[model samples]
Target: MTPHHGFTPFFTGDSYISPASKPDWLASALPTLTFYPKAIGVVWRASRQASSGRYDSRHWCESSLNIVRSLETVGCRLRVTGIEQLRKIDRPCIFIGNHMSTLETFVLPSLIMPWVEDLTFVVKRSLTEYPVFGHVMRSRNPVVVDRVNPREDLKTVMNEGGKRLAEGYSLVIFPQHTRTVQFDPTQFNSIGIKLALKNNVPVIPLALLTWAWSPGQLHKDYGPIIPSRTIHFAFGEPLHVSGRGTAEHQQIIDFIQGNLDNWHRQDSD
Candidate 1:
C-alpha cells in the first residue's frame, strides 16, 4: 500500500523490524509496502477522524511550540534574538533564511507565529507526497511548486505567494534552494528577493544555526535534552525594495550576505 498523507504505519505496530532494515532504506521503502499493511491503514483512518477546519494560525502556533518542547527533551536548545524587530513592523514580510538542517522546518513557526497571525511557506512538491507530514503541510495551504519546471514554478510562486501576502500572511523562503552540508555562496539564488519585490513586501533575512543538531546519525535515540548545544537565530532588519532596477538585485544579495556575516560574527564572540 502506498503511504497516503497523514497515514503511515511506521509508528503504529510491532512489525517494525530493526536489524532487518537499514535506516536510510527503511525511510525510503516503508511507504511502498502494500501487502498486509497495517500502519498505513491506521494512519489514514486517524486522519479521517481529525478535524476538517481550515488551517488555523493559532493551532499552527500551538503545534510548533509543542514540537519545540519535545525537541528540548532531546538536548536541543534554540537561542533566538532580534524578534522584537519583527513586532514593530506593521506589514506582512518575506522571511528568507539559510537552509541547513531539518530542525528549522520544525522550529521556525513557533518563533514567528506569536508576532504574525498568519504564516505559510514555499515547499517542494515532493514534500506534499510525504506520509503524515504531507497531510499536515497540505492542510496548512503552503505554496507548493514543481521544481522541475523553473519557469512555471516561479510564476506559481509569485501568484500564490502574492495572494498569501495580500491575505496578511507572511512567507518563509529558503533561498539557498537546498540544504547543504556546509554553506556555499555559489548555491545561493535571488528568487526569494524577486518574490519579495513582486509582492512589494519587506524582506527579512534570517540566519539558522541548525548544525547544533546533527541529523542522519546512526543513533536513533532522541539525544540529549538539557545543556544541549545552543542554536542561534538572528533576524535582520527588513529590507524594502527601493525600485525595480539593477540596484534592487544588488541590494538583495547584500542583505542576505551581510546578515549571514553578522550572525557568524556574533556566534564567534
Candidate 2:
C-alpha cells in the first residue's frame, strides 16, 4: 500500500501461477467462494459511504485501490504494464477496452484513477440502478446505457461522455455490450472510438485478461476466483482518431485480441 507516486502497478512480476506451488491447500479449492463475499463487502461499505454523501473523489479512489489490494492479499496477483504511457498524458482521454468480467469493473479504477485522478466509466444502465451499489456508481456520474437501444446509448455517451471529457475527466468504456471470459471482436462496438474522435481526444487502448475472476453460476459478480490465475492489463500507446475512426477501432480490436491471445497461451503453458 505505498503512495501512488511510487507505485509500480504490478502486484507480482510473474504472471504464471502453478497450483502445485500453492501453499494453502484449503484456500486454493474454494477461492471463488471464499473471496468474492469479502470483495462484495468492500463494495457495500463504499456504496454506503457514497450514498451518505461522505464519499469524495479521494475517498472513492482510495476505496478502489483498497479493494484491489485486499484481493491481492487474498492470493489474486496482478501484473499491469504500460502505466508510464498513462502518466505521460497530461490531459484526459477516453480509455477503451474489452469487457472481460466484473473483475475489471471493480479493479480498474485503482489502476487508472491514481494516474488520471478524475475518471469514470460508461456503464450499463442496470449498474447504476443496482440496489445498494447503484448509489455508489451514480455518484461517479457515469454514462449509463440500456443496451437495448444502441442509438439512444450512443446519444447518451456522446452527449454525456463528451461533456465529461471536456471537463478533463477520463472515461473507461467497455465496448462489448456485456462482459465475457473470451474476447469477441464482433460484439465490440466503436462507440468509444467515435466519442474520442468526435471530442478530439486521444483514445488509450486497454487490454485486460481477467478470467481469473470467474463468473458465478447464480450471481455473476460473486464467482469463483482462481488464485493461481493471474490478472493482466496492458495499455497500448494513445491514438488520435482521424477521419471515420474505422482504423482506430480496428487498432483497438487488434490490441485487445493480440494481448488476450498471448496471455492465454502464457497461462496455458
Candidate 3:
C-alpha cells in the first residue's frame, strides 16, 4: 500500500540518530508490551501485500519505517551514519556485512531503498521459509542458499547473484555463516567479495548492532525487545573489488569489528 507517514523525509539526512526524547511519553513509562506487537503488525500487513503481489520496495520501506517507529516509541534509540555512501555509486553493488540479529533484516530497507530503488538480499533458504516474514523475503527475489555447503552456496550466489546485479538490483549479503549476537571475525566469509569481484561491482561494507532485539532463546528470529539497548547501522565507503578479494574481504571484517567495539564501549560508558 502506501508508505508510512513521512517515510520519504524521515531519513533524508546523511546520518540519523533517533531523538533523545521518546515520541510517545505515555508509551515511555509503560513496559515493552506493545513494542514487538506494533512492529510485527506492520510486518504482517506487508507480508499479506507481498503474498498478493502488491508489495515492492516502497512497501518494504514503509514496513521498515514503522518498525523503527515502533522501536523508538518504546525508547530504543537508533543511530545511523554514512547514509551518503549509498549515493556514492551510480550502479548496483554488493553490500556485505556481519549478521547479528533479525533487526537488520527489518530495518535496513528503510535506509537503503531511498537511494537504491532496486535491492534484494542474499539470505539463507530458511529465511525464505519464515512464516509471514518469509513471504516478503521471497517476493524480493533474493539469492537464497541452504547455508549447509559452502561450495554449493557460493555457486548459487555467483550464478543467481550475477543475474540480479546485472538487472540493477543491489544485493545485501551477510557473509556470517551462522547469525550470532556476538561479532566473530573468524566466522565471516568472503562470498560477497567473490560475488562482487566476479560481477565487476563495488562492495560496500555495512556495520550494524541490533542487540536491542535480543536473539531469542527459543525462536531465533522472534526475540525479546530490550528498549535500553541502542541500535546502530554504519555504512562504509565502497571498495572496488580486485584480484582475489582477500584484502577487500578483510577490510569489510575490520570495518564491522571496529564499529562493534566502539558501540560496545559507548554503551558501557
Candidate 4:
C-alpha cells in the first residue's frame, strides 16, 4: 500500500507484502555505477526541504516511502508483516531491532510513523553529522549517541530517550554497535529494554533483514544494492518490561532471531 500524509495510517491488514516483480529493465544499472548517487539525490532533496523548514513529520515519512518505491522500481521486493502491532498500542513505546544495513534506518520511518505518533530513532552520532542526510535526521529530533564510550552512550540514551518518551515519541534502537548480516545475541544489548523499564513503556521487537543494501567495504555504509534479495520487516507485539526485564529482553532477542532463522531457511528451500 502507498503511504501518504492524508491516507489511512496503517494498511488494511497486519501485513503488507510488495507484489512479486517480473524482470525489470530498469534494474539494470551501469556496471560502473553504484547506488550512492541515487541515494544521495533523494537525501539531498530531503535535506533542502528540511533546511528550508518545510519538512515536517509527514514530509519525513513521505521521503522514506519514496525510497521504498525507488527500490521497488529497481526490482527489490518488500515483505512486511505484523505491522498491525504498530496500531494496537495506545501509549509511547520502545522498539528494539537488529541492525542490518542503512536500508532499515532509512525505510522504517514511513512504515512506523503512520501508525504511531512521534517516531524517532537512537542513531549513532555520526548519522546526525552526515552531509545532506544529517539535516533530514536532525529535524526528527532523534536520540544520538557517540558509540565510542559505552557508559556515556548509555547515559545519553537513558536520559535523552527518557525525555523523548515523556514527550510521546516512540524510540527505535539498534543495540548492535555496527551493521552485520549475521545476528549475534552476544552483540545485542538490553539498552532499549532498560530504557523502557525506566520510563514504564512497552518494548516492541522489530526484526528486519535489509541486506539488499549490504555494508560497504571502504565507506562501511556505501555499499552494493542486491535487488535479488527480498527486504523483510517483522514487528512483534509490544512487551512490557518489568522485574529487571530479563524475560522480556530475551523474548525480543528470540523474536528477532527466530524470524531471521526462518527467513534464511525459506531462502534455502
Worst 10 residues of 3 by lDDT: 1-10
Candidate 3 lDDT by residue in tens digits, 1-269? 12232346467668998988755665666535668778779978988999999998778887889999888888889999988887776788889998888889989988887776488999888889988989999999999999888899989999999999999899999988777879888888898998899899999999999988887778887677788888999999999989998999889999999999999999999
Off by over 4 Å in 2: 1-26
* lDDT score at residue 228, model 4, on the 0-100 scale: 75
The 10-residue segment of model 1 with minimum total lDDT is 9-18
Sequence-dependent TM-score of model 2: 0.89
Q: List the residue pairs that clash in candidate 4.
A: none
Ranking by lDDT: 3, 4, 2, 1
TM-score of each: 0.71, 0.89, 0.93, 0.94
Cα lDDT of model 2 by residue, 1-269, tens digit: 22243444433332323223332554566665666677778889888998989876666766677777656656777778776667666678989999878888777877677667478999988889888888889988788888999899999999999999988789999998788887889999999988988889899999999887888799886677776788899888999999999999999999999998888898889
How many residue pairs clash in model 2? 1
- The whole-model C-alpha lDDT of candidate 3 against the native structure comes to 0.86
Clashing pairs in 3: none
lDDT of 4 by residue, 1-269 (tens): 34334656534587887766653554556311434566677888899999888888888787788888777767778889998787777778888999999899889988888766678999998899888888998999999998899999999999999999999898999999888999999999999989999999998899999998877779878777887788999999889888999999899899999999999887678
Better of 2 and 4 by TM-score: 4
The TM-score measured for candidate 1 stands at: 0.71
Native-structure RMSD, model 2 = 3.5
Which number leads on lDDT?
3
lDDT of 1: 0.61
Which portions of model 1 show Cα errors greater than 4 Å? 1-51, 217-228, 245-269
Each candidate: what lDDT? Answer: 0.61, 0.80, 0.86, 0.84
